[model samples]
Target: MKIPHKAHVALVDGERFLFLRNDGQIFDPKLSKVEEPDLEATNFSAGVKHQDQGGQISGSTDLNELAHAAAAAEWLNAKALANAFDELVVVADPKTLGEMRRHYHKELEKRLVGEVDKALTHEPLEKIGEVLANA
Candidate 1:
């Protein structure tokens, strides 16, 4: 459960994300913030609706789904800045994690170290390390 020094860690949700770099102190690792993307209010619809063949109604896409996609895209951009990391850890809710997995570039996939499928985006920074370690 020991994270390597300078490993990249990302805590993410459907609407927000935080990137950090571990300082290598396993017992008391310091996570220096690298990037924190601003999240905007999700718009559910653009005033358009359509009926399916089954007479079901829906918008072009669910706003929540769109938000998750956006978050994943933002994460990809941030990861690209680092080009590649020694190791990469991702912590996110199950749904968001799936979204990220779907969008991961081949290079990023090779760099992935671990993934914690839980929503720890709102947890305290100190607690986050514990969760990741336990996972």
Candidate 2:
């Protein structure tokens, strides 16, 4: 399917996110940054211990907490886009993508135009469009 012109694109991972707006150009579509949150500073550790069925003990990292934080960020981004854009594309790692799906608001879900289950947070800005196009 063709990506909508001037749609908002969100690149997200477990610990970082980038918001870009498509400029509606041809192969030379311009993407401008709208926001990048400091996800590294947001701790997802539970700092607690748990016992397994085998009586084994482990210091469990709170994956749920991480997912919640990531979902919240996505929600905020979606809310911001709701007013300015009619479509949104999300490119997220598999784990974060699941979290986003679980927490997406009805309004955001309605505006979703596309989704890519790949981690592109570390890719260069110039390559994002190419990646999305290929996906």
Candidate 3:
């Protein structure tokens, strides 16, 4: 597969796994596009610490959380788009759609944070705008 020179970040938040493709055109995560996979649960048992908090958790656990959040966000997006696509079955699912949106976003939030962290891990403390400039 031809991986683009573009940078990408993959991570699991609550109940979802997210893949962010960086186009280097926007600041921070402004124009980043995210793809999420349907995950099982939040069970980080891999001993990842919570940022100098003295607690450790597993990667699995963290992934679960990300999945859930991502699913919630998907639900919300579906709802907002529901009215636009009256012909689609998903558009008719108002309640389920809402739940999915919230879940999708909840899960994605963690993943987004992780993605950003990884991208900046080796950086020399620069604003997201600097990265976008490379585009």
TM-score of each: 0.71, 0.71, 0.26
Q: Kindly list the per-residue Cα lDDT of model 3 for residues 1-135, writing each as its tens digit.
A: 111334444432333344445454334433243554554434333223322333224332333343354454454335334432111111112222333334443333323222122223233223332443332
TM-score winner, 2 or 3: 2
lDDT of 1 by residue, 34-80 (tens): 88866553433311132243323434334465465455545555666
Worst 10 residues of 3 by lDDT: 84-93
Candidate 3 TM-score, C-alpha based: 0.26
Candidate 2 wrong stretches, greater than 4 Å: 26-28, 39-65, 72-74, 77-82
> Residue 55 lDDT in model 3?
29
True lDDT of residue 118, candidate 1: 89
Evaluated at residue 3, the lDDT of candidate 1 is 66
Q: Which stretches of candidate 3 lie above 4 Å from their native place?
A: 1-5, 25-30, 41-135
Give the alpha carbon lDDT tens digit for every residue of 26-88 in model 2. Answer: 445467788775543232332112224333334233454455445555555557555756788
Give all candidate RMSDs, comma-separated: 5.4, 4.9, 13.5
